[model samples]
Structure formats: structure tokens, C-alpha cells
Target: MSASDPRPAAPRAAPALPGVAGNPRRPYVRPMAGWWLRNPYFVRYMAREGTAVFVAAYALILLVGLVRLAQGEAAWNGWLEALRSPLSTILHLVFLAVFVFHTVTWFEVLPKTMPPLLVGGKRVAQSAITAGAIAVAAAASLALFGIVWGLTR
Candidate 1:
């Protein structure tokens, strides 16, 4: 290749997959400082991922309960006994934290995701929407707890 060859400079490596002019996708690049914290997408992803962890743990608790029921009354009692174990206690605590965090974030995002509810010719405010949702969630949870308590007795 002669120095005088009439050719454009070698095109820069194509930006990763589905590359766009302005929003180039850099799939494998390491996130720079604060990228994880500052990026809204990453924040949402982390919150969702953490919630999944807690859900899995909670499912395991339910699974043990089911197994206990399958094995008759004695096994069910043992399952309840195991529930008092320190490890299970810790797991439940962690799950409670994650569940609350997920609920808060999901509610916060509801206004953005949902269409505005109109009442009496006026659009409901986002804060009001969130508050209403929280109230409904609390009521449902209490109802469920009561029903479960009733059934177990």
C-alpha cells in the first residue's frame, strides 16, 4: 500500500452488535467509574435481580412447608421446628428486606408505567396513586395473613 494510495483511513472497528451512530452498543466493555450507580437501567436491573434472589429464598421456605404437609403431621411439626433454626431466621429477615425494597421501587415506577387514572374529570397525582397502591397492598397482605391463620388453626 503506497502512502499516496487513494483510500479512506481504515474504518474504525464497528461498534459492537446492533451498533447505532449515537447510541453505540458496547456489549463487552467494562463499566467505567460510577456507571453502575449512575445508570438508571443498571439500577433497575440490580433491584430486579436482588428481588429475584429473595423470591428464590422465599420459594424454598414454601417448598419446605409443602414437603412437611406431604409427610404427615409429624413431618409438618419438624418443618415448623426447622423454621426456628437460626439460618432460616436470617434468611427470612433478608427476604423481608428485599421484599420491602422491591415493593417500594415497583410502586415508585408504577406511575411512570401506568396510564393516569382519572376521577371526577381530573387526573390522579402520582403520589396519590402510589399511596393508594400501598394501601391496597397492605390490606391484601393483612387479609391473606388472617386467612392463613384461620386455615392453620
Candidate 2:
């Protein structure tokens, strides 16, 4: 090597920590191995899937109701009576929680699956759509509950 070769110095990496050896950009927070389980997205996913269990139970309840209705007025009354039972009430409460979760999550994902909507040369957001759907569901549920309660009374 000649003394006067005039070679350029190599580029240096930034320090990892302000006082550490190398890497300047803040260290990215990588998820742990089982991160999916702990991730908010995954939490929502699990909640969404969990709703299925409640849906199944709700369907079973409906099936029981249908069976009782078919048996006779006495049987139907018995089914109604069972619905008023403590266990049934608890199950319904759980189902209601799951149902709300399912409805919210379902609507939250609706905008993603469907095509975008444009009105007045502006793009409508997914959140807005989800909110609208949720509002509609809530209104419908309340209306139905009121009608049923009115009829029963």
C-alpha cells in the first residue's frame, strides 16, 4: 500500500442507544414469540371468534323454544318458564355480552370487506360506516324489545 493512496473512510453506523455502541434510529419494538395472543388485534380477533360460542348457545335456546312450541301450549309455557329460570337468565346475560361484542366487531370489519363509498367527491371513512351499522343494530334491537314487551304485557 502506498502512503499517499488517499482512500475514503468507511461509513459508520449510528449508535443504538444515545450512549451505546451502534444504531441511532430508536430500536423498533418487536413483538414477542406469542405476541399475537397479546396483541390488541388478536385480542379483538379472539373476542370475535368467542362470539360464535354465544351465537351457538343462542341458537340452541331458539331450538328449545321451537320444540316447546311444537309440543303444545303447556310445553310452550314451560319453555317460557324455563327462560325465566336463573340459569337461563345467566346464560342470556353472557350471551348478551357476547352478542354486543360480535355486533361491534362485525360492523368494525364491514368497511374493510366492502368497496369504498364516495359522496360529493369525498371518500367516506370505514369508522363512520361501522358506527352507522352499530346505531342501526341498536335501534332495531330496542324496537324489537319494546314491541315484544308490549305484546307480552
Candidate 3:
């Protein structure tokens, strides 16, 4: 109380928890099971993230085809014949769907991840940016397809 007092001040006590006997040390952890069900956005994001597995599987399939091609003409032809089967066709369709979902989700998120673009000193709209990105991707894809078709013909 006095300005010249030499006695150390008493340490303050921890705040008491109501209805609980002692302080709990660990924080509660949420379980990850069914986390995607919590919100529509989370579901969409998770579905987009899950597409990577399918994409990787498709890439591996392509690598296998390349390996078969290296084995000989017979092996390559066999792989192509196998790919012509109903099961392979179904799998490819599913992979294509997943790839499309992944691409759309990626474009949707691109503007958020990247710095804002300015066109003629005005900030570009996010929707326009996404559309422009998709258009560029489509053009590149078509060019690649044309090149491949020309080479194979």
C-alpha cells in the first residue's frame, strides 16, 4: 500500500472454472469423419480435392500404355484393345467427369489465390478472370488436340 514498501505483491490466483473441479489441460479435438457433410462448400471442396486421386490413376494408366508401347507393337495393340473394353470405357468416363470437376473448381479458386489483376487501371472482375482462364485453357486444349490429330493422321 505504501510507496516505500519492500514486501513483494501476492501472486494472482488462476480464475476458477464454474461447475468444473479443476482446469482441463487438453483442448477438445473434432473428428474428421463426415466433415464434408457440415457445409455445401466443404463438400464441393472435398470432392474437388478427391479428384486428384482419379487424375493420378489416369496418369498411371497412360504411363502403363507408354510402357506397353515400348514393349512392342503387339503389347501396344493389346493395351489399346483392352482400353476398348466396356470396363475401361466406363472408367475413362468417370475419370473425365472427375477431371472436369477438378478443373472447374480450380478455376473458381484461382482468383482468390492469386493477386488481383488490373486492366487499364481498373480491377478485373473475378468472374471475368475465371472465364478468361477457362477460355485460354480450352484454346490450348484444342490446339494440342489439333497437333496430335495432325501427327496421327
Superposing all C-alpha atoms, what RMSD in Å does each candidate have to the true structure? 8.2, 9.6, 4.1
| lDDT by residue for model 2 (1-153), tens | 467879866679653574345646565677677766877999779779878988987898899999999999999999899889999889888888888889999999999999888889898998899999999999999999999999999
**Which is better, 2 or 3, measured by TM-score?**
3
TM-scores for every candidate against the unseen true structure: 0.67, 0.72, 0.78
- Model 1 bad stretches (over 4 Å): 1-34, 150-153
lDDT of 1 by residue, 29-64 (tens): 676877768878898878776798778878887998
**Candidate 2 residue runs with Cα over 4 Å from true position:** 1-38
**lDDT score for residue 153 of model 3:** 100
The top-ranked prediction according to TM-score is 3
Q: TM-score ranking from best to worst?
A: 3, 2, 1
Error of 2 at 53 (Å): 1.5
lDDT of 2 at 54: 80
* Preferred candidate (TM-score higher): 1 or 2: 2
